[model samples]
Target chain A: MEFSSKLLENAVNEISQLPGIGKRTALRLALHLLRQPKENTHGLSKALNQMVDDLKLCKSCHNISDTELCDICANPMRKTDVICVVEDIRDVMAIENTASHKGLYHVLGGKISPMDGVGPHDLNISSLVEKVKSGSVKELIFALSPTMEGDTTNFYIYKQIKEFEVETSTIARGISVGDELEYADEITLGRSILNRIPFENSLKL
Target chain B: MEFSSKLLENAVNEISQLPGIGKRTALRLALHLLRQPKENTHGLSKALNQMVDDLKLCKSCHNISDTELCDICANPMRKTDVICVVEDIRDVMAIENTASHKGLYHVLGGKISPMDGVGPHDLNISSLVEKVKSGSVKELIFALSPTMEGDTTNFYIYKQIKEFEVETSTIARGISVGDELEYADEITLGRSILNRIPFENSLKL
Candidate 1:
């Protein structure tokens, strides 16, 4: 697309560099900013710049944070001895929203994807191992997504701390609560059947 | 969704304020930016702020431009006497891509939409009428979208310029070039038949 103004073209180019945003969408967004009050654009720019420049990761969990430790890690009531291992802060937030996991989180930052040149060494795995070796963590739940990389990361971490006394387990794999059985993928369906719990256990929830 | 960082939340809120973007998409975008180099975020913020602070509208046609006159308005090769009226710079860019029209453009900024509290006075209509009254323009082609507001805007401009010696016409309404006849909408199909040009006229294109 041809832009009449150099500044407009620059803005569109920068915006389209974001994931999932195209040139057309960038143009629309740039035009929307142009039509809005100057303060709105300035506010957005300020917020983005500030977030990128000053945002922190929790020293304990490696989750995105405003301070040295994230709120979840800092909360005294949260179960520090039980840490939930996940891919990123988004997963941490998702699990937090459900209020199902009272444990602290250990964000791996990303999965161990050899296809993307990301290895175990590049993740927060070493610190997690250190935490386990310190003998403070009693249980480390693997909460990454059900993918090849997730399984690989989980196995890799499990191997690192297997000698320790910490109990290791993965989150349950099952069909969604409201989904039809026929619509469930074959692997999930098979796993759900294999991992079926007692009827009494199901009622506990 | 809960954010561990205040800056992250602020950035997501600002990004979500853009049209069609929701909270989830905003968070994804923010996280993507965070994962990238600080330079990417800084570049985007700088570009947006610079554009909002420095971008200008063409003095003659009101198209978004870096200078007083837009490229089309400044071009000596283009026909200044035949002006194409459009809704915004997007339409200007769309028509420019076709390379069919050799005339200049008059951007109305937006259409007459009462539902949106927009009217002729809210647009650049008065300046367009003044341009026609100046007598340099011999023909004005209304190229607004075929919507109720577009029709109202076209008629409003036509009424304002009726006293002038200049001629006024709306772009032809018809089925798209590659569309199937059976799938064509009733109004468009009927208008195409009613406004059919001579066989020889069609051959000229």
Candidate 2:
């Protein structure tokens, strides 16, 4: 769309560069910023600049943090021997909210997708293997998604640390608690049947 | 959603302050920005700041501009006496793209919405009236939306300038071009029928 002012055009162009935002949405957002207090824009700009400049990643888990080591890694209460492997910080947050795992997390940054030119080396795999090699980590849980890329990354990481004496397991796949069995996908339903656990085990949760 | 880093949380909060963006979308956008090169964030921040700091509005028409007068008002070839009154610059751009109107525009910024606590005094209506009182304007076309607030705004401006010698009109409302008659809403269909022009007059376009 044609913009009356070059400054407006530039702002919209930069905003639309974000994923899922189009030119129309960018225009709406730019206009919204224009209508708001100048301090609002300043705050947004300052926050964005500060984030890009000062944000750090945990040296141990590769999750985004404000310090060298993330809070989870620095905490003494959480189990350090059992590390949950996931794709990124979003997954880390999701798992943390559930409070189901008492161990630390190893954020791989992203899945190893050959289609996207992301290989094993592109992720945070070597450091995880290093943790296992140190003989401190007793168990590594593969908490990646069920996608092909997720499985590939899981297998690749398992192979790298297989020689080390460490227990490895994957998160269970099953029908959602409230979902109807008829609506479940065939693959998931079949897997749920094959991996069925004792009735008492379900009650433990 | 929980953010591990304060800087990340701040960025997401600021971004979510924009219209229609929620916390999850803001987090996604913040992470996407982090994945991009540092220069991209800098560029977006700089553009937003520059737009808010240096953008100007047209002295004559009140449309957004980079200078004292907007490009439309600055152009000597366009008719100066005919003014199309619109709610904002977006409408001006939309009408301009159609290549249907060659007159300049007077942006009212917004409509009169009592529910939203907006009144005529809150808009650029006074400046528009001042332009009409100057007697140079030969016509004023109301191009605001057909909403109740838009109608109230149009009526308010019309009462302010009815004594002037200028001709006044509103943009026609009808079934949109290429729209099926059966699918058209009752109000629009009824209005289209009531305001139908002669077949030969329609052919003139």
RMSD after CA superposition, every candidate: 1.2, 1.1
Note the B-chain TM-score for every model: 0.98, 0.97
DockQ of each: 0.91, 0.89
- Over 4 Å off, model 1: none
Writing each residue's lDDT as its tens digit, candidate 2 over A1-205 gives 8889999999999999999999999999998889888889999999999999999999999899999999999999999899999999999999999989999999999999999999998999988999999999999999999999999999999889999999999999999999999999999999999999999999998
C-alpha lDDT of residue B71 in model 1: 89
lDDT tens digits, residue span B1-205, model 1 = 7778889999999999999999999999999999999999999999999999999999999999998898889999999999999999999999999999999999999999999999789999999989988999999999999999999999999988999999888888898888999999999999999999999997998
Which window of 10 residues has the lowest lDDT sum in candidate 2 chain B?
A: B1-10
Ten-residue stretch with the least lDDT total in model 1 chain A:
A65-74
User: What proportion of the true contacts does each candidate reproduce?
Assistant: 0.99, 0.90
lDDT at position A57, candidate 2: 94
